[model samples]
Target chain A: MDYLVTHSPALIVALPLLAAFAIPLISRLGPRVRAVLCLAVLGLVAALVAILAVDVHAVGIRLYTFGATAPEMALPGGYMVPVRIMFEVDGMSIFMGIVITTVAVASLIYSLQFLNGQTGQARFYSLMMLLYVGMMGLAFTGDMFNMFVFLEIASIAGTGLAAYRTNMADAVEGGFKYIVISAVSALMVLLAIGILYAQYNVLSIAALAHYMQYTTLDMMALGLLAGAFVMKLAGVPLHMWAPDTYTVAPAGTTPMILAASYTSMYALYRITFTLYGGHIDTAAIGWIVIIVGVLSMFVGVMMAVHQTDIKRMMAYHAISQGGYMLLGVGVGLAVIADPVALANYGRDAMNGGIFHIINHVFYKAMLFMTAEAIFFRVGTRDTNKMGGLARNMKWTAIFYAIGALAISGIPPFNGFASKLLIYQTVLSFNPVLSVIAMFVSLVTLASFAKVFYSAFTGPEMPGYKEVREVPKSMLIGMGILAACIILFGIFPGLIVDTIVAPATEALINQAPYINAVMGAAP
Target chain B: MSALSYEAYAVWVPIVWVAALVVIGVIVLAWRNRGQKSYKKGTAQTDIFLSGIKVPPEEQRHVKAENVYWGFFEALKGFYSVLMRPHTGVVNDYILWFVALVAVAILILVLGA
Candidate 1:
């Protein structure tokens, strides 16, 4: 128990990676054995993440160094530089870990029945586990180059999964586009890493932060990292791939893909807050993020209203919801220099943004699952052709309604809690931004209302009268997320106090993070 | 000061609105029924308004999903036109947009520096 608790950071990532490799061999046992193996692996990963979260909150940051005598012994004898790779498990990393693991377990369970009897089950399970490994590594790694490596692993796994349905031309096309964009953006990230390495001769993020001078090369690298990550997160203008990819990917995989996108968003936050803290022009970068966010919100929602395909519309909403996070955090960044403002509103804005990330993982996953349930029964995603499904699929309708209400920011759901915080804080920072956020929420509601009325309500269509409800396992998968949406909505305070506050403090206080890895940071 | 004080922000407002709507609906129903002795089922009173044009039963039951927000769409036609044009669903166009945004980001960062 002691060893597991102590070295769990490395184990959490390594266990799944090893399991992923063993899956193909396990497939010879049969589909049922492979399915159980996938679930057990993800389930253990979820347990480890929960324990890590509890441990992180109880203790301080946990740093595990590879190929070294001690965790902090990054330097060799008589050497003045650190070359060892380390994983730093802070409050933020643990929080993201919990989100990823929860979604992974639920999606994998859902896929058990959702992708049952499909060909390439072994390959699918392997790719799913590898994807989890990438996200976990990216979240916990304290090294910059390692972050890139993990990112490429995730991108490749994700591209393979996105293109998994090889029969459909659109699925292939979407996968090709996704890989192209991901590969290009990753190259840019590598270029930025190379630039940083060239100048500082160090790849450790903490070491780089300690010696940051905000020089010309550092500025260029910052721009490149920021651009690549924002594109990866599908911020508008760069969001065209999202609708295409989301529309064609297997229903169970869409939520995982969404989680991958959040990992990129996490990278953006980590880079700006910890890697470049107090070294750059906060106001300038804040404005840049705010502009991109505003554009994403407006453009994403406006485009969604015109979409007839259910998944495509939800993809647009994903971009729009991402905008809220950006807007809230950007407001915090914009006012970081003003202590008065930071205390007054910036803290709340940051909390809202971070909280929304967790809230989004639940409700959006539920929404996509419901969309998948519809597709499972109706064999189509076009809303124009769907109608009166609620008559047959009672649980799915109820679940879809809950998800729709939660996402639209109606009260007593998690979205309302987070969006309300964002609204109040952004209102304090700039009334115009608050108003825009509210307008975007309204449009989101209107668009979802269209989805509900079209897909679930009205008279029974001619062919759908005989349609039966989806399988039980699929409902269970969606139920977990629905329960979370309700739980987080009612107890936002508890969640904030326990997880979000510590995560926020970890983001704000950069000195300790650097000190943990660099031995007091001189 | 509390970042998560949701209750302090009138969390019951949605419930209250829902209750008020239910009460108003009941009162309206009572007032409108004051002079009526009885009502017939599926007669002229229950018939859906179709601008006084007679329609077949199948056509009468048909409701178009896209037409639900006709008025709203009409009001935002110009905005919709601009927003819809760029969603070309073409891969090259998507890549172009990403590249353009990267250029814009670099330009801004350099200028800020």
Candidate 2:
């Protein structure tokens, strides 16, 4: 047990992967036993995340290379390999892992009943576990190339989950589109990786960091990587697949996608600022991101406003909120040239960007799960057909309001804090973009207000007028997610200082991160 | 999250910068602008073209101002289509995608050598 604590990062990745494989074999066992085992795996991962988080806080950055190979020079001369596939735990990665694993726990609990009559329950749970494995792997791993592998793993699992219900044409179509778009992104990322490997022989982020000469090739590689990530993040122009996919996929799966969206974005942070080491001038690319972000915000929200389906609206808004995140990243780059401004804009802007990704995951999950409840009771997610759901599903209504308020960046919510920082950073960095972002936020607020007014308030429609509260499993998931949103809102500084701040620092402070992986030069 | 925190409460206080005061003053301006627009509408409202045969305009051709992107969406028709397809959404296709992806990884690994 003590040994496991020291190697908890492995447990974090392992328990889920093992469970995923183990579930199919256990199909012959009682359903209750298999379900308990799934819960236990989630519990173990959650415990591992908490333990690793505490350990990282104490140790600063807990590096556990895969296969227990120590970081060492593989051959004589300049050649060195990072020990194993390192599960490098800084505050940010651990925090993300905690959120991801915690959410998986909730979703699985929600799934037990959701998948009650659904055939292939074992397969579904297996895919869920696989997704968690990849998500944890994505968050914890320090290397860029390794990140891609994990992404592929997660994407495969996600695609499976998206198509879990093959009877629905929407699910099948949505899942296909999801896989194709994600594959295209992965290909672009691979080409970028190829370019990087040619420039720097080693694939380890630490090795790349040491070789941070910003040649045109390096810049081109970065461009490819960024383009790919934007697709994965479902940033503007590349976000066409999300609305359909979210609408069709099981509601339990939608939150994971939202979580995955930000995780990919975080991977980009690791790539650009960490591996490349702020060496490449990215003002041009950042400006492009800002424009895209602006477009995504207005465009995504506008499209969302026209949606009668509730899940689709949340999906589009996910894309829009994604814009807010990238806008922060863009502002960080555009304003971070001067040392004085760099400290303020670079660190603060990145903090806000990263924090918002985490914040969005919580609130968005709450909202999605609430939508799930609506669908469960009303047997539909059509806003035009729903009204006065608050009267019956009081807890759901409260949770949904919390999600809506938080997402809209209303005061005293999680979104408000992050958006405020992002807005402030943008305003100080470039007031013009800030002005555009402010209008975008206003549109977002207005759009969500429409959602609330249409679906929760307004005149009570007949068909779903007698809708009862959802099962206990569903409420539990929504409740935890809603609680997370409220906790993050008031005490953001606490989480930000520990998790977001450290992650931002890790991204920017390249020297230490590189050394931590590669060790000092002989 | 910045070291120099711009606490909203502090920034939003009454006794702030001149620009801040000017910005605060715009709420009233916007309010007044809305009021003026409403007043203009009050006088402007009349039967279209003074009781001429009033054919209701087609819903699609409504003359209200709409977003520019409403038109832009059609221009970027290719872009909009990207959101929709590759749609034979079989689980087997996903498996194929993964297998192809894995093959690419192996190819990259071998070719890199």
Best by TM-score: 1
In candidate 1, clashing pairs total: 0
Q: In candidate 1, which residue pairs get closer than 3 Å at backbone N, Cα or C atoms, i.e. clash?
A: none
| TM-score quality measure for candidate 1 | 0.94
Clashing pairs in 2: A66-A85
Q: Which stretches of candidate 1 lie over 4 Å from their true place?
A: A76-78, A520-522, B1-4, B7-52, B58-60
The RMSD of every model to the true structure, in order and in angstroms, is: 3.0, 8.5
- TM-score of model 2 (CA atoms): 0.81
- Mark the regions of model 2 whose C-alpha exceeds 4 Å error after superposition: A69-79, B6-8, B11-113
Q: For each candidate, what is the lDDT? A: 0.86, 0.74
DockQ of each: 0.40, 0.07
Instruction: Give a tens-digit lDDT track for model 2, residues A1-522.
Output: 667666787778887899899998887796888899998889877887877777776677777766543422222344355434566667667768877876787788777776666788889889989888888899888777778899998888888988888998788888888888788778877887888889777777777777777676676666667666766777766677778777777878888877787778878777766776567555654676678788788778767755678898889899989888888877676655667877856678878888888888888887888888888788777776667777788888888888888888876678887998888877788898788878877777776777677667644455555788887877777777777787777677777887778777666666667776666554
Chain A structural similarity (TM-score) per candidate? 0.98, 0.94
Q: Is the docking of candidate 1 incorrect, acceptable, medium or high quality?
A: acceptable
lDDT of 1 by residue, A257-368 (tens): 8999999998999899999999988988888788889999999999888888898899999999999989988998988889889888898898998899999888988899
- Lowest summed lDDT across 10 adjacent residues in model 2 chain A is found at A68-77
